[model samples]
Target: MSLNPLRLASKALIALFCLSVLTGSVRPTQLEVVRMQGEITMVTRNSPTTFYEDRSGPTGYELELAQAFADHLGVQLRVVVADSLSDIFRLIDTQPGVFAAASLTRTPQRERLVRFAEPYQQISEYVIYRRGGLKPATPADLLQGRLMVTAASSHSERLHDWQASNVPELSWSESPELEVADLLQMVAQGSLDFTLVDSNEYRMLQAYYPTLDIAFNAADQRDIAWAFGWSRDDSLHQAANDFFAHIKPQPLLANLAERYYGHLDKLDYVGARRFLRQADQKLDTYRPHFVDAAGEHGFDWRLLAAMGYQESHWNPRARSFTGVRGLMMLTLNTAKELGVKNRLDPVQSIHGGSLYLSRLRDRLSDVPEPDRTWLALAAYNVGFGHLTDARKITAQMGGNPDLWLDVKEALPLLSQKRYYRHTRHGYARGQEPVDYVQNIRRYYDVLVWNDEQTQPLKGEELLASSAITVVPPLL
Candidate 1:
């Protein structure tokens, strides 16, 4: 009864084998899947928006949705991270109780093959091209060739519809082996003149690949929904529908969307490009200091490094016009409180900053993480007092004070005299902290991506520890 996933899966396999022989049929029904496997075997492709590996294991928008559905079914979530759209559909087609939550657009062709749950989100398809390149003015212009898209994608359907009459010569190659990110990269490099991507995918990747511009809208807005095997019995389909009905109007959807795409628009093409370049140039110099501080404070060294970049762009000698100085950009009073004597010392600055952040995080012991860590970052920028006032406002406005998503919405109201006048900490510039936390999160994501793809740099190698501790940094 208290078995782990491996044991449960093993028992499920054995039970399924027995059932196949007993029923004299190998094909499992929805009820059979639920009875045999103690988990929801959901199918999806690996992408930023669909499903992908991270430090915490597999995570993404669709994965979260699938996990919720599994919980609703009172079972575990077993994600099948497929390589292509076709593979995703195939799993749903062949496996009982299997479903695809890869942010699939509910197209007519797909609707004919599999049943779709109630639509959850809507998206539009667009033809994308490199900025300043030969942009396609219409389907005919695109028909000249150099078009690429993922095989069996909604984009291909749009192309087929166009080629049927509008541009009978229109042709686009589908790379069954490649993902949307790969195709977008090709368009960015000018290897392909055109490709189609959903708006959500573009929003998630725009910060990273800013040069890829939208050429034209290729299709009308479409609904995204989960896919189940087409069957006369609608048990799983009905269950999925009930799950959607419950979450569609709740804060969960908004919060989840914010978690992934909230900071996407924070950085522009030039800003992101600049950050990546300096991530190599200036960050390496102060990398050791941040690493030492991070080791002592128990934080991701890159997170600390990203904070340093955000604070002062890793410039040890950099001074803000507001009298904040050095790599960590600490004020004299705050630096003194953190036992930082020389605010300009790069190593001391990072250590002081880390300690100050730790102290702020410590004060928020009652708050749950991620929000707790984010609130600490906000407090670090403005003041803890102002953050409290904003939290109070969040509660007064019927928003959850403990959730960063809700608190952030209330934060900007601090600038209004009508709102901040009654609070103890009055008229604080709240937007600064929002930008601060979001930017660092973006930078940290980039750093993590780089580390996963390449090797991570350990600050211990560049500089020996003088006296720092090994406490994990604040979240």
Candidate 2:
């Protein structure tokens, strides 16, 4: 009773600290909690742009980014897949998840509920419609058809803003059960009139849904960032910000973007349509041969198939003006070397091509995949000597010789005298391999998507497909 008021308050704080220590109730910082758990949980949506399983287990742009962050923290990554975009936000709000990395755009409405890390990407939203349909040339024309988007998505938020400010008549429905890919499919099938998709996503998926075309821009230049919960403890948030700052200047970020988004726009509407048609009408006849050869040579069957399509459009008797022929397009010397008796025979041609590609890949044992795979494919197309010349040029130009992105750039230089003059191989059609690899990657993507749609993963296999291994530090 006689103590000073400040003294009494200090005494109370000391008692509380002692009690907290005795009861084991001391609150740990978010970073400490994560360190104790030895794992960081990532909340994401299951989509091509977010998280999904491919032939090589779980791999997506977001998943890989999350993996890298987890590696930086020296912790394991635990992926939690949410059903919808709304579910992703709900999980981040309620759960102790580290962050949501599902390619979320930072909208004004979302900023009120959660804090966002540094913006990593910028994209535009486009109103998508099927070809041969009445295109909505302007925002006012959006009212002419049935438009829909994912519930709780930035696309819907954009629509709401448009409806409020300029076009009061612009209206659409929100589907909580479907994703952007589903909406695109609906538009292509004529079930829905139009939908909105981000430019990056539309580009990545356009080859699969060739009929869908961008009508107009719904929103432009939006920032995409990782979302964290708004809380008193912002240790994780600060750490994430630091992580981004460290990587922003490095090649790690650029390589990740190039890996996922660089080659997507290689095929146009007409080329995609033609590829799809041929894949449907002709690919089946040689599927068994591709499967057998790929299995024998340790390659994905779809990849082998894509290579065949790029080589000859899957024609058994395809002949190039330079004397390469057949489904895999083997020259006489290469065919003889690979023990291919008849280059026109589909089975023999596929086996020979697969073995040859595998041998080329093995030759570059020092190179890391998927760069190794891509380099091998380039060699398969432009000859190993020319590929070596390009790698030399890449190193000379101060680019990594192992990265496909750098090598592809240097490849075109081979056609020019100023660059190729000092090279072992003096002149080559360098641009051909660039286009060739891009075309195969696009075709392979379509095939993978088509296969997934027809046969999706389920149950135990789905659970086992998580990307858990820590990636080595980026160069």
Highest lDDT: which candidate? 2
Go through the candidates in order and give each one's C-alpha lDDT.
0.82, 0.86
Error of 2 at 98 (Å): 2.2
Candidate achieving the largest TM-score: 2
For candidate 1, the lDDT comes to 0.82
Question: What TM-score does each of the candidates earn?
Answer: 0.87, 0.90
Q: What is the C-alpha RMSD of each candidate to the true structure, in Å?
A: 10.5, 9.6
User: In candidate 2, where is summed lDDT lowest over 10 consecutive residues?
Assistant: 466-475
Question: What global local distance difference test value does model 2 have?
Answer: 0.86
Which runs of model 2 end up more than 4 angstroms from their true locations? 1-26, 455-475
lDDT of 1 by residue, 1-475 (tens): 4769998899999998998899899565575578467877888887888888875577898888788888878888887778778888888888877888998999999899899999888888888888888888788898554776777888877777787766766665666766676677667766677889999888887766768788888768999999999887778889899988888778878877888888777788798889888886777777777778878877788888888889988887889889999888999999888888898889899999999888898999899876888899899999999999999999999999888899899899999999999899899888889999999888887777666655422323211322211211112
**Tens-digit per-residue lDDT, 349-427, candidate 2:** 9999999999999999999999999999999999999999999989988999999989999999988999889999789
Q: Give the per-residue Cα lDDT of candidate 2 at 270.
A: 92
